[model samples]
Target: MDQQGQNGLMRTFREPWRSRGALAYVVAALLTGFYVVLYWTEWLTPAAVALGLRSKWLLYGALYSVAMVGGAAYYLRHHGNSRYNRVRIAVNVGVQVALAFLLPLIMPLFGGPEAYLSYFWPLSYDKLWPSTLSSLPVYLALYFIVGSLLVAPLLAYRYGKRWYCSWVCGCGGLANTFGDPWRHLTASSTRSWRFEKVSVHTVMFVAVLTTFLLVLDAATDGATGTFHWLVAGGQWWSVKQLYGLVVGAILAGVVGVGFYPLFGPRLWCRNFCPMAAMLGLFQKLGRFRIAVKKDMCISCGNCTTYCEMGIDVRSYAQSNQSFTRAACVGCGMCAHVCPRGVLRLENAPREQADKARVRLPVVDL
Candidate 1:
């Protein structure tokens, strides 16, 4: 290539906002907002609650997404957010506890079946439908068996990261969301990078294994366990319910360090994200993935530091394939930062891994 052409290409490569993680922030907000609105407005359900679509997970995803964004926003406001650690914890437990007490009151408003909230019992949640879920052993058999075979498999297949476990139907996102700000304090290894890597890979393994276990258990109609006994007294202060309140000063301090002090409010996304584990599992068998390119590459490693998940996009960026790991959030921060315009997030078929000698610069990474 002519020097003029080379120079022009080099000139096009430099964009600083990519390094600043500007787009990551943008995408996160947009997604958070998208789901928040959907749930808040009931935008998904039709005029037919009798069809049972109202209780589907899209609604739960929206509800949980609101919880996550709330956690991030909360951590961002409280500087070094160790300050808000207890407050955030309180908010989460309080919301759930309140919901427990309130669901009974709230259900009448919805004109739904009246159900009892077990305050301190083994059954965490139970809704007594107007009729039994199934009358016969075979029909009852489907309840347990289909739990794993149908709902679990379909949910896993549809949203790779156990979206139900993380953002969609996630109950833990309430806690994990607050965890972001405290990430650095919980940075266990002297090797921050290593600590981050081990945690994600570990969770990725657990996520896949557990997700499959859930599927298997559901399919087998096995009666797995739940901890509904934690809801003592039907309010926040009962002994069991109180156990949910302890968010640990150490953990809270970790949030303050990671999000409030060090990275943006999602630092724990690196060290302790089981949601990633679930997502990572789904990601492997799933359709979409981040595509990377190496040949036209200049290795100015901006994408690595910007990763809230602590994924080294630079390593992936230097490759010619879609990163098969589940950790990649499909967050396009890497593609947004390429100096040589070598990175991109593509849904190209797996067979098309190397068709582009030089891929276009992704503006929306």
Candidate 2:
């Protein structure tokens, strides 16, 4: 193994829970069931009360923080030798605990708005909605508007989506930590990539459309009665309700984490996250790329195998292609797992990247 490669055996396929084995399915079922109960029923409310938590969401947040902490320790035990991995995991875990979990939980007690600093539109999905913004304090409303419309895209353009997706977002944090064990299970097939391109962007479009309709409904204020009813009226079948039920509750909460043992950690990030889709557009215009060293790839397959996003990294390595994929969350696993030191993640000027790519000889695949 190269110096940057993983330090010990992952034993991914051999492990029943990590592999798509019977145990994996069982775990998935349990997770799905838990989310179902949490979302639809009050069964966990008593548990929350017993624990002195204000709501089931607070209980869920506490559990989520614990899982990330435990999983981070497990991940560090195997990959902590690398400074990048160590620091990234630590920062990610810290962000989840403090900003995502604790901050929101504590804010309401002091008569402040409950805000998840780590989230923005369209992942939070409602942050930009006119109704939601109107209900918030001016500072928080401005924060969401500026953060989502300007700051998030600017950061993605400068550092790629990694600044948020890898280092700050709770979804990505949980995926990198708790979902680390099943990272190898992400499908790298061309079919999977095709589906991802269509599905993720489709979700993005719907999110934008939904937000637009919501804002318009608020502006009309029931004058466009049917449109208002369809968009955001208090009805079970309203667009807002459906999006919350299907995209937010089912896709993000249930399928995303629940299917992790079977589909890998990035099921949501890769194929369903509207926020990822939006940021990915900025990432394509950004400086981030995985620079592949020329003619040094041994075809060991570790890089592709460990990619949580299902990117076929070995093909790029074999072709000596310094490349950027929109799906890449910049988790650094490809560079970390390459046994021949054939890959590095970097941010550089377009001219420098072009020059470097031109110098590298493309091997026949």
Q: Give me the candidate number with maximum lDDT.
A: 2
TM-score of 2: 0.95
Give a tens-digit lDDT track for model 2, residues 1-365: 33545665557688888888899999999999999999999999999999989889889999999999998988887777778888999999999899888898899999998788888999999999998899899999999999999999999999999998999898999999899999998898867887899999999999999999888888888688788888887887899999999999999999999999999999999999999999999988888888889999999889988889988888888887888778999999888878788999999766664545543322222
> What residue runs in model 2 are displaced by over 4 Å at the alpha carbon?
1-4, 8-10, 352-365
Cα lDDT for residue 159, candidate 1: 46
Over 35-64, each residue of candidate 1 has an lDDT whose tens digit, in order, gives 454434555566325444335333443344
Choose the strongest candidate by TM-score: 2
Clash count of each predicted structure = 15, 0
What does candidate 1 score on TM? Answer: 0.41
Per-prediction TM-score: 0.41, 0.95
